[model samples]
Target: MPTLKELAKRPERLTPGHRLCAGCGAPIAVRLILAAADKPVVAANATGCLEVSTTIFPYTAWNIPWIHSAFENAAATIAGVESMYRAKRRRGEIDEEIYFVAFGGDGGTYDIGLQALSGALERGHRFLYVCYNNEAYMNTGIQRSSATPLGAWTTTSPVGRVLPGKTQWRKNLTEIVAAHGIPYVAQSVASNWRDLVNKAEKAFHTDGPSFINVLASCNRGWRHEPSETLKVMQLAVECCIWPLYEVENGVYRLTYKPKEKKPVEEWLRVQGRFRHLLAPENRHLVEAFQRYVDEEWEKLLKRCGEA
Candidate 1:
C-alpha cells in the first residue's frame, strides 16, 4: 500500500478542469480509489452530480476508460464489463491486468441500485463498488435518500412545524454491504485520503466482491463553507458520527479511532442542515441525536471487539 506522500506523486486518474463544484468531495473520492490501483483501471460512474459535472457532453475529466451508467446500475454495468474481460482473457483475446471500480451516489447505491449491487456481489463479481455518499439526492434538488442522516433538512424531508427533519437515522450502508458477506467492505471519507486509498487497495485485491462507503460531502447541499469541507469531515470522524472501519471476510476492524472523541454537537454545529436542531424548541432532537450516535458508536466498537 502506498502512503499519502507516495500516492500524492502518482498520476491522478481523475484530472482537474471539470465542472464539479468547488470543494465537492466526490471527485476527490473518485481520484483516491482510481489512484489506489496497482494496474490500469476501468471505471463506471452512475448518473449523478459526479458524472454530469465531470462529463459535460463536449468535455471530460476522466483520463482513463470510463463509462457513464444509469442512476441504478453502475454495479451491474461494471459486473458485465468484468465478466466480459474474463471471457476475453479465457479466449486469449486480451491479456492485460485491469482493475474494475463503480462509482455511485447515495441515492443510487443505498436505494435504487442496491438490488443490482447485491446481485453482483452474490454472483461473486471481482469489482469494487464505491458509493460516494453525499447523504442525499444532491444532484436532484437535494431530495432525501435512505442514507441521509436524521434531523438533517432536505427538500423531501424539510424541517417544518410538524416535523424535525429526516424522521429516521442514516442507513448503515457499510454494515448493509457487509451483510452480503463479500471479501471486503469498508466505511471511509475523502478527507482521509490515506485511509480511503488503503481500503480501495484491499477492495481491488479481493478476489470476490468489495464495497466502500465514502463520505463525499456537498457544500451546497449541506450548507457549509467551501473551505470548511475537509474540516467538517474530520469533525465527523472525531465526533464518532462517522467512524473509520473495515470488515474483511466477516472480521470487523476499526481503521481510525480518535484519541479523544469529541461531542457530536461539534459536528452538527458546522452544518446548516442541522441548524434547526440547535434551537431551544428542538433541544431534544440534539439530545436524541447524541444518544443515537453514542449508541451506534458503542455498537461499532463492539463489532470491532474494542468494547
Candidate 2:
C-alpha cells in the first residue's frame, strides 16, 4: 500500500480541463479512486456527469485508459473488459498488473443500471463498481431517482400542494450491493478523501467484485453554492444521513463513529432541496426524515456490532 504522501504525489489520472460543474463531486471521487489504485487502471464510466463532462468530442480529460459505457450497462461493460483481461492473462498476451473500475451516478446505479450491477456482482468479476450518488438524475435534469432522499424537492417530485418533495425514501444501494455477498462493500462520502481513498484501495486489491456508494453532492441538484460541496458532504456524515462504513466478506464494520450525532436538520439546512421542510407545515416532514435517519443509523450500528 502506498502512503498518503506517496499517493498525493502520484500523477493525476483525471486532468483538470474537463467542464464539470464547479462543485460537482463526481470528478473528486474519480480522482481519489484513481489515485488510490497502486496499479494502472482501466476505467468504464456510465453516460452521466463524469463522461459527458470529461469527454467532449475529440478532447478528453482522462489520462488513463477509459471507456464511456451506456447509461445502464457500465457494470456489464466493465465485466466484459475484465473478462478479456483474464483470458489474455491466461494466454500470456498481457503481462501487466492492471486494475478495473466502473463509475455510475445514483440515477444509473439505483434504478436503470441496477440489474447490470447486480449481475456483475453476482458473477464475481474482479472489478470495482463505484456509484457517485448525487441523489437524482442530475445530469439530465434535477429529476427524481431512487437514491433521492425523502421529502427532497426534485423536478419530478416537486413540492406541490398535492404532496411533499418525494414521498419515497432513498434507496439503500450499499446494503443492496452487500446482499450480493461480494468481497468488499463500502459507503463513502466525497468530503472524506482519506476514508474514500482507503476504500478504493481495498476495492482495487480485493480478489473479487467490490462496490462503493459515495454521497456525491451536486451543486445544481442540491441547490448549494459551489464552495459548499465538501461542507455538504460533511454535514451528511455528521447527521448520520450517510454513514461511513464497510462490509468485508459479509462482516459489517463502521469506519467512522461520530462522537455526537448531529440532527439531520443540520444537513438539510444547507441545501435548498430541503428548504420546504423548514416551513411550519412541513416540520413534521423534517421530523420524519430525522426518524428515518435515526432508524437507519441504528440498524447500521447493530450490523457493525456497536448496538
Candidate 3:
C-alpha cells in the first residue's frame, strides 16, 4: 500500500488553475476523491461549485469521462449512467471495471436534490455520492442552505436585531444516508487527506451505493482569511464542532479524536458568521451548543464502545 505522501503524489485528476476562490475547499475535496477513485471512472456533477468552475461549456478540467447535469439531478443522472454501464457490461458492450460517481454540493444533496439521492440509494445504484458541503449555496452567492449550521450568518440569514444568522441546526446527512442502509456512509474533512481518501477507497470497494459528506471550507463565503482555511477546519474537528467519523454497515466510529477537546469558542471565534455569539446571551447559547456536541459525541462514543 502507498503511504499518505505517495497517495498525494498520484496523478492530478483535477488539474490546477480552475475558477475556485482562493482557499476554496471544494477542489481540495475533489482532489482527494478523484485520487481515491479507480481508473475508468465516469463522474456526473451537479450544477454547483465543482460543475460551474471546472466546466465552462467550452473548457473542462476533468481528464476522465465526465458530465455536468442540472443542479437537482446529479444522483438520478449518475444512477442512469451506472444502470447503462451495467446493462452494457451484461451484453459485453463495455468492460466491467469502470466505476460511476456523482458530485454535488450540500444544497444539491440535502435540499433541492434529496429525493433523487434517496431514489438512487433505494435502488442500490453502484456509485458514490459525494457532498462537498461548504455549508451554503456558495456558487449562488453564499445564500443560506439547509446544511448551514445553527447561528451562522449567510447573506440570506444575516445577523440582525431579530435574527442571529441561520437559526436551525445543520441537517444530519450522515444519519440520513446511514438510514438508507447503503453499506457505507462517512464524513471527513478536506484537511484530513488520508481519512478522506481512505473513506473514498472503502466506498468504491463497496458493492452498493456510498455517501461521503466532506466538510469543505468556504473562505470567502465564511468571511475568513484564505490562509486560515485549513486551520479553521482543523479547529472545528478538534473543538468538537464537527466531529470526523464513519458509519459503515450500521456501525459508527469517530475517526479524529482530540487529545484534550478544546472549547467551541475556539472554532466559532475564527468565522465572521458566528460574530453575533460574542454577546452574553448568544455566548450562553454557544456554550449550550458545546453541550450539544458533547452529548452527540458521547452517544457516538457509546456506539463505538468508547463511552
Most accurate candidate by lDDT: 2
Model 2: lDDT to the true structure:
0.93
Tens digits of per-residue lDDT for model 2, 185-290: 9999989888999999999999999999999899999999999999999889999999999999999999998899999998899999999889999898989999
Query: Model 3 segments beyond 4 Å from truth?
Result: none
Give a tens-digit lDDT track for model 3, residues 1-307: 3467777778888888678888988898888888887666789999898888888767788888898769999999999999998999899998759778899999999999999999999999999999999999998888999888878889999988998788887888888888998899998999888888889988888899999998899987887999999998888889877778888888888887889999888888999888888788787669777887788778778877788
Model 3 TM-score (2 dp)? 0.96
- Which of candidates 1 and 3 is the stronger one according to lDDT? 1
Instruction: Please report, as a residue range, the 10-residue window in candidate 1 with the lowest summed lDDT.
Output: 3-12
Worst 10 residues of 3 by lDDT: 1-10
User: Could you tell me how far off, in angstroms, the CA of residue 226 lies in candidate 1 after the best superposition?
Assistant: 0.4
Q: How do these models rank on TM-score, best leading?
A: 2, 1, 3
Q: Sort all candidates by lDDT, best to worst.
A: 2, 1, 3
The TM-score of candidate 2 is 0.98
Extract clashing residue pairs from model 2.
none
